[model samples]
Target: MEKKVQQYYKLKQKQKEIEKELAGLREEIIAYCSSQDSSDAELGSYKVKLVVQNRKEYDDAKLYETLSDPEVWRLLSRADPAKVASLVKLNVISDERIHHTYTLKTVTLLQVDKK
Candidate 1:
């Protein structure tokens, strides 16, 4: 267990170092793309495409107070049929837009010794 814990910490440190390097490279790539006015570029045989995504989020409190109604619910219901599945499970009354797909999960290392 001790050995696995040590290995996990060591690997995590290395992962952070790689993540920093990756962030730096991403910035450089974006810089190059902006300078060349290109959304995509060829790197040897691989194509590097820069994608930018945007979303609109509203305050849950405001949504609960003024926005959420039978009309807005009907609109979202038609636009996203599957969304209602998860929202139905939630106990909240706010029908405000949220980032349901963008979820962060912690990856913990657990080791069990054979009895």
Candidate 2:
């Protein structure tokens, strides 16, 4: 009877540990999903452009194509929002001279939750 009691206590302890681990994993998953969702929203419609003087004799301009939603989400999931915003600002500054560069601005469309 004593042996059985000890076994039961051990099992309960193990169960508690497992439950704690599961809870931690659940939180991590939730965080990951939230980040992915944010990224998906950001990448849905984004663009950037560059304007620079080439050879100091001619003005050269370049446009960086926006990534697809999936790609943008994948990237945003791993990127910091502040960093992304900073890059966008930098691009805007660099391309300020070019009128078309305004079109290259990044626009984050908010996702509406459907009930």
Candidate 3:
């Protein structure tokens, strides 16, 4: 068990070192591309995208208000009343209802521009 744990830690440390090296190389590639004549390039099989991504932070007020809508609540209420009962069990059901939240979004793309 101890040997396995040691090996796992060693692998994790190696992963961090490799990630750092990759990040530095990625920055170098992007800088070279940006200084070049075009924003698009194809290496062998990879393409790099240098762009700002869109981000959104929603207001929970809209979330709860949307839940108050009868139609939306109907779809959810069909699941089980026991879950509804559990909310009632907590007593915060009045202000805090049962719902889910969107946490994160991600996309990966590769582009290589020639300098």
lDDT of 1 by residue, 1-115 (tens): 9999999999999999999997777778777776898776776656666665443343344434453587656545432424543453463333334434233343322122232
Which ranges of candidate 1 are over 4 A from the true structure?
Answer: 67-115
Candidate 3: the clashing residue pairs are 47-110, 47-111, 48-110, 48-111, 48-112
Every model's TM-score? 0.55, 0.32, 0.45
C-alpha lDDT (0 to 100) for residue 56 of candidate 1: 34
Q: What is the lDDT of every predicted structure here?
A: 0.55, 0.44, 0.57
How big is the positional error of residue 107 in model 2, measured in Å on the Cα after superposition? 31
RMSD values for the candidates in order, in angstroms, are 12.5, 19.0, 10.7
- Candidate 3: residue 16 Cα off by (Å): 0.5
Clashing pairs in 1: none
Query: What tens-digit string does per-residue lDDT give for candidate 2 at 24-109?
Result: 76556445546665333322343222222222111122222332345443544433434444445766323233333223333332
In candidate 3, what are the lDDT values of residues 1-115, reduced to their tens digit?
9999999999999999999998888777767766885456666676666654432333445544646867655644543444444444666354234334222334233455544
Best by lDDT: 3
